[model samples]
Target chain A: MNFVGRQAFRGPGLTFCRLLVARYSSKTGSKEYIDGLVKGKPVVVFMKGTPDQPRCGFSNAVVQILRFHGVENFDSVNVLEDEDVRQGIKEYTEWPTIPQIFMNGEFLGGCDIMMDMHKNGELIEELKKAGIRSALLEKAENKD
Target chain B: MGVPKEELEKKLRSELDPAHLEVDDQSDGCGAKYQVLIVSQKFDGVKPTIKRHRMVHGAIEEEMKSIHAIQLKTMTPEEWEKLKPS
Candidate 1:
């Protein structure tokens, strides 16, 4: 991850500089870059596209599931943009496949595990364990 | 070259010693993707689903490099028997 936050580019002339740095950093394989992104966010999804516009069905399913659980704010990295990061993440997690999910710097499995956890009510417990409160669970509790 | 379904079955059968195993090549003619169902004593104590997945992945780590995707359904013998229709 770039040490410079997006907020730092509020200056008039710095927007272009940020874009340049983004392009430059992605060319180099930086495990630190990946680590920084995962460590800083409570929930990190390394998927094919942004949460708003996922490039694949599996990625879209994960984004929708997170939304259904009322998790609105989370970090998403578009793996399609960077080849190094794409391959690097597979090696980093030792898991084959994209749309990987990490919570509190721990590897949770891909879409299949997410769906399984969601079905069994384990996902809500997982979110709470990571210090994220789920509105879905809250709604269920209120109905009781 | 992509991995063959028989190769994956042979690997999992030898490694996990599964009581039942079904390996389906879902990649059409390419043999690049697979859907596997395994029932074994090895999965009995594997707590989380992800760890169970890791055991399967580890069993076929070499073949996994050439394969595109693996959709796995792992169960202990008891769980497998419970899910059986008859």
Candidate 2:
């Protein structure tokens, strides 16, 4: 009897076992979990990597922009670790891209939108409306 | 597997009736990425950048599935006119 088939079977079986565990824990679904995460935070970014070591340029750009605006505290979810959460967030927000931003539980746009808003001074205004203060104004005032 | 730039342009044209539209295939022959600049009256009075993006994304939701990335710039006709050269 050949052991190759049994070895292959074992590999797949192990993977299946892990998948079952993931599914059970995520039973509430990624959408609900994502909603819960974004509900309380004034600013939440679902990005590809952690804030300090962003894996993607788009995600890095967002982090820098937020920092430039003086936003010191915000939640960041790294989607690279979980395939389900990565895909689930796209469906949850109806947005096809990563580095998505949510403000006050509302789906904000991606990096491009953030850059545009930042250029037009809309980002600062939106932060103010949400009761979050940015350091951009302080920098401008200090410069004057 | 990938959406053609022309197909995306057609969908946006029909839905938004943009006064000015430019769709560039940025995927370097893969046809998976695109950049669009659209100016339309429909965007008038649209507050916030996210809402405007959602309007554009809504118009091409089906095609979006096949697209890998979309860098979109949306503007009102008046804004477009201002940016236009004399």
Candidate 3:
């Protein structure tokens, strides 16, 4: 398993530095680079296209799942934008798929797992652990 | 060019020994896309979902190279039964 596991919580300044390295470093798609890309982010996805206009059905499904949870403003990497990243991510995670989701720097599974987790309420629990309160929780509370 | 459904099925059956398996080629004649459901003991017991997926992907590593997309539903028999019962 190439699972990166959960990283320790980081301060905003340290997170900013990691993001900067992820964005500006020439070694795009390297292990260190991807680590930086995901580190400290509440949610991140390496998908086929931008979240607004996902090129693939699976990627679009992931976008919808997060949206239903009222999760916006998450980081997204369009693999189509960079060939190195396109291949590098598959090798990095050793998982053969696009639309890979990460939560708190841990590689959550792909589209199917996202859907499964959403269905089983695990997604909400995960977001809560990341200190994100899902909008669904609010809706349920409002119903009560 | 995509892989033949039978070949993909055979590979997964042999590799994972799934209790229940369904491989659907959603790409019509071209065979580029697939939706696979595998219910197996291999997916059971404290295994994270990501690891379960990796097990399936690893089984079809070669076919995965040429395939454009795959939608996978991997679960242990107990999990599968809860979601879909006879």
Candidate 4:
């Protein structure tokens, strides 16, 4: 892990991370761990690691994309930091993978889908359609 | 014990006599969520919602009782041919 990245999750003895790991590691308990996160954030990402310190390349891709669009307020739930979140998210979305993004209480798919939408400008379109009021898109347009 | 893929396939095929069926075992080793892409002549001019889902519901009968979700990609064979994934 990056030194700065480790510092990003220093609170609560990093017990939150450990709990997440344990949750995904086991099979049948607190399955709603992921649910609460999604409900907590209008834009929640269940990814390989945290946003500022993505542990995997896929999570990095999403972080980069969002940063490119000036999206800084999104919350990322690190899947690697928690096992229950890792497995339960897959079960919840039935997508069997990581780097999943949820927007306004809806599954927005993974990197491939997000990148595709981003590249084709569909991501902005859909985000607008979903009424996200993304300062990211506004900022991107302003800079352009 | 759960509604297996074979059961899903059989239930759908017998009910719809679909031109083609793709019943994915998306249980992710736990047997719950499934992603199905089905093409049937019976759905030649059907609405996207009813065409894709009700067809599966009609076929699965009992399995739909448990499968929490079904990501449907329903189309007529002609539509499927057009979307042949290049």
- Indicate the docking level reached by candidate 1: medium
Clashing pairs in 1: A1-A33
Every candidate's DockQ is 0.70, 0.68, 0.70, 0.07
Global CA lDDT computed for model 2: 0.83
The CAPRI-style docking tier of model 3 reads medium
Candidate 1 per-residue C-alpha lDDT over B1-86 given as tens digits, one digit per residue, 9 for 90 to 100: 68977888899999999999999898795888788899999999898999999899899999988987777888999999999769
Task: Write one digit per residue (lDDT tens) for candidate 4, span B5-82.
Answer: 777778788888888888787666454566777788888777534334555665675675566545566678898899
Instruction: List runs of model 4 lying over 4 Å from the truth.
Output: A1-31, A129-131, A134-144, B1-86
Clashing pairs in 3: none
TM-score of 1: 0.85
Deviation in Å, model 1, residue B41 alpha carbon: 0.8
User: What lDDT is reached at residue A85 by model 1?
Assistant: 82
Task: List, residue by residue over B1-86, the lDDT tens digit for candidate 3.
Answer: 79999999999999999999999999995678999899999887846677888888889999998888898888898989898966
- Please list the C-alpha lDDT of all candidates, in the order they appear: 0.84, 0.83, 0.85, 0.68
Against the true structure, candidate 2 reaches a TM-score of: 0.82
Evaluate model 3: give its lDDT.
0.85
For model 2, the stretches where C-alpha displacement exceeds 4 angstroms are A1-24
TM-scores of the candidates are 0.85, 0.82, 0.86, 0.50
Better of 1 and 3 by TM-score: 3
